[model samples]
Target: MTGAAAGTASRPLLGSAVAALALAALTALVASGSDLVSAFDARFRAGADRAFGASAGSWLGPDGPADAVGSALLGAGLLTALGVLLYRRRPGAALWVLVGLTVQFAAETALETLVGRPMPLPADGSAPDPGYSFPSGHAASATLILMVLLAVLRTGTRVWWSCLALGSALVAAVGVSRVLADAHHAADVAGGVLLGLVVGCAVAWRVGVRSPHLSGKETR
Candidate 1:
């Protein structure tokens, strides 16, 4: 293999390694129960709770808006349909997106199981603190979905650019919403985004290197 080919081949492995390291660091940070992290999380929850007021906050609360968005993304079966379409049209690209999302899901589950970070409580004791809070699964899912969509639909048109911008904004909103709902700490969302991006880029790069025809690039 040429030097360029060798480098291209190695990118996925490198990206996966970096993603694993990020997960490990996040797990340790949550497990250690760092005083600084606790203080920051407390302050964030307090600020959000104060800003949104009780009623409005409850509507946009953890199990309300966040769960609704996540469910719509998964429960409504959009992702599955899209995956099927891509699988029929571009199997390489479909596999890349699937692999990336799978990696994110596995990493998030492991961290949630091992770290068991507790979420901050609301003032009125209304919001439920149900599961581990190390990495925001919603944020990770949103990020992965958006990135995969962008990769598969790379049309290079005005519409394509617009879609990319809108998708990125949507992903950011989901991540921020997790914090606003006090469902996760700022760091948890951040770590999830990092992991998603790493895995997404890794898979995309690998797919591009292996099969350019499937990368949504126009061939004339």
Candidate 2:
């Protein structure tokens, strides 16, 4: 490969490695109950709870809007993107999307199980959310889905920027909602975003490198 090609190839691998390492470090910190992490989590959760309250309704809470974006919205977006790719005869890109999603899901699940961090208690004294909480699954899912859509539909500079802005807003909203609902720590959200980044970069690399036809370049 030429120097430019080599650099392009290494970029995704490097990004994934860095993100993975950061996630591992964060997981260790959470797993070990680091005092710093605990203090930050406590402070942030307290502030969020005060600002939004426990009864902030489903729209601003973790279970309704955020969950919808991560699950139903993501599902719809993924299916649509896959359809576009297949319609354009880019089966390789579609395959990479599936592969990347599978990897992201597995990684998120493994971290959640391995860390086994408990969810924050609701401000209203309700029972805490069930299951491990080292990483916010909603945050990860939203990030991955939005990123995949961005990669698949970036047909022009204007479209790419628009998609990026929208995707970022959605991801941030999901992460913040989790904190507001006391469903996860801020660290958990950060870890989930990093995990998504790791897998998303791999998918982008495969789609851009192996399936140049689907790179979505603008025609003159």
Candidate 3:
């Protein structure tokens, strides 16, 4: 094969290998991160308890900035904004948005039921820490939201690289937020980010390869 053709053939393989490595890393982080788990639980609970001065004090405490920022990043409102932008720039990104939300929500509900882990808060509480901690639904959703936004941006190499940098930062921020809020352990958030990155990357990569404009652009 010609050099260009050979390189093209290797792209998917390299991508797949990288994807697999990320998955395994996440799995390990989730399965064997007890120190992080203890640290997240203690620090978050202490911070919340200190700030809130009660069981549920932190819900509307000084963490307002973090909550507001996290909500804007992780909420349906933000998702809607992202959807609108993607619809205008790259409609295929919309499909991934739907898919990512559906997968995370459905899996969280089903697994929480199966594992029967209780939330740290009440049933009707917005911060219910109950259900399975294996994967944090909030963190998953937040991380995905960030990735989808990044993916939907213009797809030149510069844009793609920029998205990668910003998206990674956003995902990490959300994960940390969950831990700081005492809503989830660090391992839980780590798992959430891992799952999100893999799922989001796959979906966004498909969109990129299939996008008429993006696919046609050559990277120097």
Candidate of highest TM-score:
2
Q: Best lDDT goes to which candidate? A: 2
Candidate 3: tens digits of C-alpha lDDT, residues 1-220: 4565445434534554574577566555445544665576667657655654554444532244555655565665346646565556655577667786787677656544554434444313565543456567667676666655644455456866866676666666665556555456555666566556556555555554544444444432
Which ranges in model 2 have alpha carbons more than 4 Å from their true place? Answer: 46-73, 76-80, 83-89, 149-156, 213-220
- Pairs that collide, model 1: none
What's the number of clashes in each of the models? 0, 0, 5
Q: Which ranges in model 1 have alpha carbons more than 4 Å from their true place?
A: 1-16, 39-58, 70-88, 150-164, 211-220
Using lDDT as the yardstick, the better of models 2 and 3 is: 2
* Candidate 3, lDDT over the whole model: 0.56
Instruction: Show pairs that collide, candidate 3.
Output: 117-131, 118-130, 119-129, 119-130, 120-129
Q: lDDT of all the models against the reference? A: 0.65, 0.72, 0.56
Name the lDDT value of residue 65 in candidate 1. 73
- Residue pairs with clashing backbones, model 2: none
lDDT per residue for candidate 2 within 94-191, as digits (tens), equals: 88777887888898889888888988766556688788887877777777666555555544668668878877877777777677656778899998
